[model samples]
Target chain A: MDMLEQYLPFFTKLTPQQQAVLSQNTTRHTAKKGEIVHNGSLDCIGILILVRGQFRVFTLSEEGREITLYRLWERDICLLSASCMLNSIQFDVSVEAKKETEYWKIPASVYRKVMQQAAPMANYTGELLAARFSDVMWLMDQILYKRMDSRLAAFLLEESQLEGGRELKMTHEAIARHLGSAREVVTRMLKYFQSEGLVALSRGSVTISDETGLRKLAEESLR
Target chain B: MDMLEQYLPFFTKLTPQQQAVLSQNTTRHTAKKGEIVHNGSLDCIGILILVRGQFRVFTLSEEGREITLYRLWERDICLLSASCMLNSIQFDVSVEAKKETEYWKIPASVYRKVMQQAAPMANYTGELLAARFSDVMWLMDQILYKRMDSRLAAFLLEESQLEGGRELKMTHEAIARHLGSAREVVTRMLKYFQSEGLVALSRGSVTISDETGLRKLAEESLR
Candidate 1:
């Protein structure tokens, strides 16, 4: 019960009997960094509530390109991975442990039963799904409207914000994978940023030298 | 009550009293083609259940480019437009009448109250939301991975199937808007398709001459 409360603050909204059922059915597990939590079409992955560390949800293209849809961090729910609970929502998307992560996994049956019986839980799930859809729409807008340089700059700024620092210790290949661009494209953009003194890039890291310049570059429509 | 049943078969799952409440509260309306059903930030648009004709849900870019996310027909619900029901799911996406459309609109408060009281209704809504998210992911995949010509061919084929015909009487500007490409880019591609004997294009229309050839062209990675 305490473990359930740790990941799900809404646990208190359920009746006492519902809380008992959920606590008894949920399993806590850990995954190592880069570990594939669920591959495409693994229908029993369940509703995962991340307790610590990061998880990435992404899809791979036929040409082996990777594009991240979104990330799950502490206290976030992995609803998309719980495909068994969702009717007629079949797609090829994967979830992986971005860092060594610990989470609580509610079995698909348990989650669905709880959701059916609990209005609060269903409303919360709906809200989460809506928020995720909004994120995907925003990403689509960026890809459709923004130029590569502006997108790269924006990505860097967002990554820096996520990491809570100006220095990002990520490879160009990693950045490209996140942005759905080629490594060469990301490297070229970083080089351009360096030339303009907006950022300093080394072999596997980028540091924002002029944060204001980078922000302005990100906001500007290069085309 | 029969009107409610026409738009939503899930109406049967509710109690008779609940059904009566829903029937009394729901508003039935029709819109002409190109009419905006709900604009951005109109948080009270409610749950729209399409009864006839087509509805398009899309997001517009700052540069005035339009990209379609999905279309709704008979029995489909416009859950995103019910922004007040979905906590923190605000965005700039708009829904429009693609053809002369008839729909049932349930006020947001009434819909939320019914959903909270009815498990089946809540589950149905979740399934609908999941399906929409799946669609957005598929679109993101097309944009991130596929080339323009290939995507255009696939879109035309899909459109032909949707309309149950080989001829699409849509202008290049309309096609470009759907594909999130420039009108010039769509014109150039259509001309190429013509030269390759895949399609015949006239003002405001495109006729698929050799669908197999177009499919092959679409599958080819002509980088």
Candidate 2:
């Protein structure tokens, strides 16, 4: 069995003929770190199932500011790269390889054909789509309802957790891109946090100084 | 032909057997104005297709702040109502009757069965899902990239165009909910707009005093 079959919902239920078609269509692809795996304008990139590494999905402003929509981990399937082949996706969403990445790509036509053929496959596609919508909605809720201070505090904590330490080696510009904010705004807020003894800021790094205080500030947006 | 059939992509291509099952499952339902049509906790509400009037889809914060995701006008179909049945969708999304509305409701089980049986129906669902993802992305773009002044200006201009008049009869709280901001923030922006001679504000109403100036302000966020 092809490794890609693991990612498919009830793959065994697919007719042997259908399975072979998918196997033929699925191709292994890789991208170097920082490479754009999918450009918004480039249509029909197809369904990407990450086998290893990470992908950052984001929207880029005209001024080149980027706000991340979500990140894809190993085993995550990206139906978004195939947006044009689907329909009515009016906004631009680009995906970049955040690290050296390996994935399996299935052309949109084959995926559509297989999905239409199998009930499980179609349901799987719907599930993926609904999941993405939920992520976007959740982010919107945070940005709209949570104060910037709360969001920034939560983000810093999130980074610290991901890096497995209190000290984060991330520049203000990098933090702003992830939070979908301006670098200056992030810097000003970090300074405020520093003054309040919540976090200690140094050149290109932020260290969790007052863990309890920072956690309380971040708790506002935690839910 | 059932009116519901018209909404389905390639309805004619569906086997007559499938068509009959769909028609049997779909039923017309109506809601009064301001009615909560679908609560996030209620699962398997299935899909909603608006026939007449309007629906507002939004998220409610714990603090009672509301941020609209998008609205469903006449002939729009809503899948978020059926989130639980679809899978993942870990966040809350509620829908309400913005006005007295009539719609066709197909139970999640039936829709899933039909969609799996028909390729065109599955494609149609995919299209709708992609379109919605685009809408959410666009809204996120506006909130992240555009300044509050630009957003407020755009919102006022949008209201004027929607009402077909310069005078918009809405409270500050109402504007704040739609814009996903605080009432104080909205009031402050309105006052600034008024001071700039861009708009005239009165009790529960705002009149666009300078259309050209307003458009220019709104234009920054237009694209």
lDDT of 2 by residue, B1-223 (tens): 3776677655787888988888888889999999999987665598999989999998887778788888899889998887665667777778999889999998988877887767667767877887877888888888767878888888888878866999999999999898877788899889999999999999989899998898898887655
What value does the lDDT take at residue B57 in candidate 2?
Answer: 90
In model 1, the runs with Cα more than 4 Å from the true position are A148-223, B219-223
Model 1 Cα lDDT, one tens digit per residue, A1-223? 5678766766898999999989998888999999999787755678999989988887778798766777888989988788878775767678999889999888888888988878678877877888887777655666576567677888889999999999999999999999787787578667656755689987779999998877875775432
* Candidate 1: pairs in clash: none
Off by over 4 Å in 2: A116-118, A148-223
Which docking class does model 2 fall in? medium
Candidate-wise lDDT, in order: 0.83, 0.82
lDDT of 2 by residue, A68-146 (tens): 6778899899978887666587877799998899999999888887776676676678778878877777666656675
Error of 2 at A94 (Å): 2.3
lDDT by residue for model 1 over B158-187, one digit each (tens)?
Answer: 999998999999999999999977888899
Query: Total clashes, candidate 1?
Result: 0
Interface RMSD, all candidates in order, equals 2.6, 2.3
Best by DockQ: 2
